[model samples]
Target: MPIYQAPVRDTLFVLNEVLGYERYTNLPGFSDASGDVLEAILAEGARLAENVILPTNRVGDMEGCVRHDDGSVTTPKGFKEAYRQYCEGGWMGLAAPVEHGGQGLPYAVHTAVAEYMVSANLALLMYPGLTQGAIAAILTHGTDEQKTAFVPKMVEGVWTGTMNLTEPHCGTDLGLLRTKAVPNGDGTYKISGQKIFISAGEHDMADNIVHLVLARIEGAPEGVKGISLFIVPKLKLDAAGNPGERNTLSCGSIEEKMGIHGNSTCVMNYDEAEGALLGEPNGGLRAMFTMMNEARLGVGLQGLSQSEVAYQNAVAYAKDRLQGRSLTGVKAPEKKADPIIVHPDIRRSLMTMRAFNEAGRAFTLWTALKSDVAHRSGDDSDRQAADDHMSLMTPIVKGVLTDKGFEHAVMAQQVFGGHGYIEEHGMSQFVRDARIAMIYEGANGIQALDLVGRKLGANGGRAVQAFFKEVGEFCEENRADEKMAPYTKALKKGLNDLQAATMWLMQNGMKNPDNAGAASTDFLHLFGLVALGYMWAQMAKTAQGKLADGANGSTSFYDNKLVTGRYFMERVMPETAAHLARLSSGAETMMALPAEAF
Candidate 1:
């Protein structure tokens, strides 16, 4: 009734059938997670999403987190209970390694599960999502004592986590941060600074809150490199790893944002906070990157998930909302009026959202699988390759997904006509909720610059070339498929466009650094479109084979894939051309304005 189905079948297609994630179980550390185990995990995750979490979404938006004068925050009613159920269910550490008391499942499985959780409730999902990233960073770079003290607690969901990188004066520009970490006598540090736009900064859902703070050492270098990361807890740990004294960190205020009201975006003040160092001294920026990288992918998942939910509801509404007769005569003539879905344009928008949502899922899984491979594989080359792929795709995952993802949400809202503007219909909330994802986690513009200016040339372009080479492999294999001739050809064209765009950015940026900043956003989108097109083609090929097998009346399942693939090729894939043209036009327009220009 809520237009929210598990999408379980499609998730399985991506997990077991297409990506073959079960092979990870063979890895020494991932022994606990196999096909049957992951399947069960997904099943339970779906049950929780549909039953436990979906019920709270509307209420969460209506009654967001309440901030109090006592510096404590209370979540909306039922949020605490729902989070308890989630923690008790072990969903918090779905992909964490077993050594840390996590479930040790493949990230591929967790990604599919994440789609469900977010579609059910994006706001509530942010709590654990941010926590998971924080714990991951601590585990990777934190001292042994820190890990022993904090890892199990977070992995068990007793406490939560937040990333503190933004400030009122600086957000994406970390170089401007004035947060200070002065060395103390006890080998600890005293952190005093202001951090803004921190999600889950102050909440009542968990016992203790672990904040990974990015601040500068007093005499450190001026920009990003000068900063260091520290682990500041809401409740200071005692000798046995439990919340003891209150840490000096407190919320200065919470941000009033356009959307995601349930998520507390805090303006935190770390006033002489006794904080333990996470890694090496003056290595805060590097340590903070661990959290940022994880957060970036998570933000992308948020985008894709919003698109999926919006598309689902829009499709349901279109099929049910009746207005007028069809131009091609009415199939539902006896029903007083034809369903809105009968109109070509309405179907166009629905298919647009549906196709993009489906392919976006595949792309996300593909990206997550790369992360899994990087972590699981024993070979150094394979590990590095997977890491390289993950790094290269992170920007696309964040920038392109959120940008197009917002478009998909808006398009879905349009399908509802006037009703979408009204909040009771639950459509406007999707739009509002998804908009912030584009702004946070390095901002979509910053992601684009990182992709174009940094990752494109990282390792001397080996990463970029390796990815293009993989696309070439996919294209070569698909050229022989009868169903993929057109798809393959279109994919090839998009690939050429991407390669040319990449080369142009690389050559031009070497001449003028500012040019990279100007052209980054367009080039990122161009890269995303081309990459997604290839993903869809591969998905179509796989779906076609599965459909030909005629397993369990999956006709509609794979039939929709072919139809949606066609829609994307015709409508969506053509978007790269415009972006490519924009990239070629040069960055003069972006940098032309003088300072303080009206």
Candidate 2:
């Protein structure tokens, strides 16, 4: 089994020190999220994660989910018990509104707990993870009756939820979706569709599954405009508002996927299942995007979660293994060989992991803070600015985090040599699990196109312009501080590179759209590098302040943070230049070859 200790210390640093979570206590739900309260909650959450859920990770993978003959699925052993505890702890409703039987905490607190849960076991986490998204959708867009009927139980964990999209023929192109919804002469509709790749689609842990489904109405307009959203439950609700009769839906089969074996990724069959209109008819895509955007952020966290765990185990192995003698000479002359940690190449790998993991953690928490403000702040202008920031950064968060996250997993696995390849060491599982994030929740390619084609120009580029202005201000303010010089210099350079790439895209992509498409991926990455660099620079500033204050007993922790930030600035920030160069290369070379040339 692999070890996974939640990075609680680093998490707290980001929450209190880097992001100034305390300043937002005046926000609606953040009043109770005091530092001491959050710290205690995090301690308990870590206990649940590290001690309970993590032990089940390898077992779940080995046993997998079993499908029975009755069109039902049973999760691997221990999942049911774990889920019971998860619900009992009120985790599902931690960030939900108080009127719905929830803690009413800020989303940032939930984000921290989510990081722990995902790091411990991503597959187990999905069951509740998807439920949160469904709950948010209902809370945001559902009718008041729908909220009264569904929100409490889902929050309390009696029933779980799933998002049903993507048929066999369609994935991202929801306009081509084929699911059908026929009117039943009442407010209800009879839905008939087969949805594939539905995570937690069928599971025995929860009493009923609430599926927020997308379907086309019988005489509706064609394409995406025709689609409507429906609340299709696996079991119908009774007069008492509990799960009553079984709905006409079943798990056709479970996917034998490469990873997340613990989660029941099912092919769901809804044979004229009774459902109610969720939002307005022909308004599904707009509603669905609310859930999709929330899911995309959660998926971005999944990237960081996998990286944190993989890096932990890799560091452990690097210290224990004794395969190499250091070039600095016989420091371990008494033994056959020195520990592999002594080697420069191994140090490089470890440092790379450390730098990215910390920077990524900061980036995630920063975005999460923005979410808190966007949703909870009273000022309309403040909310708008935060929302714009989130819209611009969503694709970068989804695309860059997953792409680099998987790469980090592979690099960590390499630290274990041949042992990493074997399942016993558990590194291969990390690699496998991280692989799916890049492909799902809108593939990286689509995310890039979204960043370039839509988000860049959204609100007349107000979001991107806001981002540029913010970074420029930070650099200008901190440039003169002697200790902050290195970080600020690197951040300024990366910011310039990002700005140049944006200009090139705007200039060339106008005449030839393929030019934008060709540069999209590289542009997204360049943007991501600058974002992470900005995080590192901010963290460096925070660490410097702490050291200057001589706060309590913390010398090493603050000092080490400065060192890690320095590593990122000097070693990793330069990748922005490479990405900028690629973005400037345009589409001519890429499109020159004929379609059949391959």
Clash totals for all models, in order?
Answer: 2, 0
- Computed on alpha carbons, the lDDT of every model, listed in order, comes to 0.86, 0.92
Tens digits of lDDT, candidate 2, 353-397: 889889888898899889999998999999999999999988999
The 10-residue segment with the lowest total lDDT in model 1: 26-35
The Cα RMSD of model 1 versus the native structure comes to 1.6
lDDT of 1 by residue, 507-543 (tens): 8887888777878888898888877898788788877
Residue-pair clash count for candidate 1: 2
Off by over 4 Å in 2: none
List TM-score per model, in order: 0.97, 0.99
Candidate 2, residue 199: Cα displacement in angstroms equals: 0.3
Query: Which residue pairs of candidate 2 clash?
Result: none
